[model samples]
Target: MLFLKLLGAALTLAGTARLGRLLGGRYASRTREIGRWRTALSILATELGFGALVLTQALERMALAVGGHPGGVARRAVALLHEGESSAAAAWRQAVTEASPRCSLTPEDEATLLDLGVYLGATDQEDQLRHLKLAEERMVGSERVARGEQAQRERLLGTLGWITGVLIVLMLL
Candidate 1:
């Protein structure tokens, strides 16, 4: 019985600790995901501004060049465009909406992307490039905030997990 009690307590501690770590990792993931988006946007800007690619072609190239959620968004937008989504802005909005749920982007991040979509392919090349630059700037701000939260929250959650496990074990004892 005593051995069984020890085993249960050990399991509890391990499980809670793992759970805490998983939760904490989300903050870091959000930051990384934001960075990925920023990089992808920069790639898109270059493709549009210098490579002389049309919006759809630029998005396809961006998708090919990048990976992860940002890439997925670009790929989906391209697919939507090919499927007769009516406009580049519509496709971008739809793709961002679909990908937002699966990604670590905050609502604000999602909104920023959606806002960027509105000007996509709707204006001259210079305007399109300007919109892309603006979005990248917003993403930089978001990444900074996410990095700060990750730094502060990740370790705290991990420690709290262990502390909570200890409390639970004590109560059981």
Candidate 2:
């Protein structure tokens, strides 16, 4: 499981870097010829979006491994809670702190932490809730920035597509 997670991280990084370089090159050429600031901005946005997507996917996979099956970390934590081995808050905090460092948490890990924190808090685990909230805040900021960039790219692409269509129509005439 650990190996798989590591492999996923490596692949995500490689893919993101390759895509960024390809888009950046295209943006540079377009900007040089047309001086369209939107093109460069769009490229930057696309890169950010791509990076977020890759990280999100990886984190989602990790979250599933933790929360999904009977043998998962979440299940084990719950079991500990039931067995009176630890309070839910303590169990959650331990699980997150231990897992975060070992798993080399990506941005998506924040989302998982936020969800788990809320759950722990609901179950009367205030300390875990506090830490999870902090993690959530951090992740939310990054996500918002990434989303803003993605929205800009989408708008720019739409404008470019319309202009291209108009040019094609003129040529056809």
Predicted candidate 1 versus true structure: per-residue lDDT over 36-110, tens digit per residue: 899999999999899988888898888888789988998888888898836888888989998877989999999
Give the poorly placed runs of model 1, Cα more than 4 Å off: none
For all candidates, what are the clash counts?
A: 0, 0
Look at candidate 2 and tell me the lDDT of residue 156.
Answer: 64
TM-score of each: 0.97, 0.30
Candidate 2 Cα outliers beyond 4 Å, as residue runs:
1-73, 102-138, 145-173
Worst 10 residues of 2 by lDDT: 33-42
